[model samples]
Target: MIYQTAESINDGRAFLKIDEFIKNNSVYVKIENMNPGGSIKIKTAIALVDAAEKNLDLKNKKHVIESSSGNLGIALSIICAARKYNFTCIVDKNTLPHTIKVMKAYGAEVIIIETPHPERGYLGARLDYIKKRLVSDNSLVWTNQYESSANREAHARLTARELLNEFPVIDYLFIAAGTTGTLMGCVQTVTEATPATKIIAVDTKGSVIFGTPSAPRYIPGMGASVLPPLFDSKNLFDMVQVSEKETVQTCRLFARRYGFLVGGSTGTVLTAIRDYSPKIPAGSVVVMISPDGGERYIDTIYSDEWCLQKGLLQLQSSTSRNTFSGAVVE
Candidate 1:
């Protein structure tokens, strides 16, 4: 079974229950959005903050800077605010406005990067901006999530263990690939204990992660334009590349069928599972990690006007019934 965790100080609050819906396979969804910052990035955010607290001197005001699409920024903003640390989040145009508002509400100074870097894309642009900020002010501590060990360790120690405790038998585990922190942690844990469960890494069409050619991906919290340093090929069973169209359709379908409105990353996972359904035997238990909710996607993923403008379809056929085999990255 696949799993992920969140930001709240309390692990109880971070780990939510598994949700089951009527389908061929015994599928369970771990709702991590119920966490304090409404996403599993809270786990990484807290890990980074905890490490910084121990290593960095708190006597002087530390201005924490990081590049994020949305969730991590909000998580860091929440933790930093409570700890009395100044936070500056560098985001890109893909980040939802509602996400920015939440970060600001938690006292985070938000900076938006408009242009994408030719090689690394928006994440590269955000990192370049962070470098300039560091040059201008050495006092700024960059919580580099893309390259941070704490980001992966937190999930290995907490999220994976918690998930194993909850479900000992996980035939198939599906995880969204962004920073690859969560994927690494969960895959390692399950592979060690069970050594048999199939681990599926789901990525968006445009993400450069998994060595796929980089393209434009509007959704945040799912994939990265650059290959994350945290990513390793070890223990990876297969990698699934999902299109944004299917992701949007899956989110809409979930909302309509299960009445659960999930974010883009979660939608990507469900869509991957649907496409991969042909290979999955009936009664095989599958676990999916839902990183965040769809509250911030009101103006985009859930908006007809936005979909039409982007030439995205409003709805598509339900993915519950397998239509095609999911394409696996080489």
Candidate 2:
């Protein structure tokens, strides 16, 4: 018999039963939202901070800068505060006030970009600000989560190990991609350990990470306008994309059925599992990664008013799976 407990938020292990939610006996979800910082971003944030400390970079650096307005910003703020390092977050208007407040509450300085880039929008503007900051100060260290190998390595070493310990023979694993760090890291470790496990990368419909055409993405967390360097086509056994509308519906479904209010990206992962479950082998152990809880999204994804304004309210309450395209199943 095996039992799981999160002794500390940093334990990097917590799973919830998906039997009630998915109606699938073999499916389970690792709840990464249970982490101390309220998301799996802490895993990589700690890695980046520790790496800086190891090389004496943190000693001379007066501040740490990151181009994030969501989970990563909050995670880094918490970690940096504990280590006595000043942290700055570059955000845009699209970022939720709740996220910015949380980061600021942890002593992080928030810089909001008033103008959006013509092509890439706020994401591009945030990156441009980071570049300017780097040029202005030599003591500011930037932990570029998108291209940082440490980001992927942290999930490979910590998050994947915890899952593998619980289910050594996992048959299928589904993960939502943002920076692609979590997806790439989990795939590297899980595939190497359980050679037959099928790894699936889930992304938002507007995200270009999986070669989908770029479009305006209202949803945050799972999609990237720019393809993250950590993304490897050959590493994944399958891929899936969920639209913003479908993602909202999945979040509502989980809330209604299982009382689990997950983040937008988690909804995307669950949507993929429901769509692909038909082709999955019987009695196969499947794990879907839930990146964060939904409390932080109350003002955006979970708000009835916001949903209505974005035309997502009409899509709610329907949990039916949609036909998938632009996906590779192997």
Judged by lDDT, which candidate is best? 1
Q: What is the C-alpha RMSD of each candidate to the true structure, in Å?
A: 5.5, 5.8
TM-score of each: 0.89, 0.90
- lDDT per residue (tens digit) for residues 109-154 in model 2: 9999988777666677789889998998888998888788888998
Per-residue lDDT value at 42 in model 2: 84
Candidate 1 TM-score versus the reference: 0.89
Model 1 Cα displacement at 172 (Å)? 0.4
* lDDT tens per residue, model 1, 57-154: 53264779999999999999987887788999999988999999999999999999999999889999999999998899878888788888888888
lDDT of each: 0.81, 0.79
Candidate 2 global lDDT: 0.79
Total residue pair clashes for candidate 2 = 0
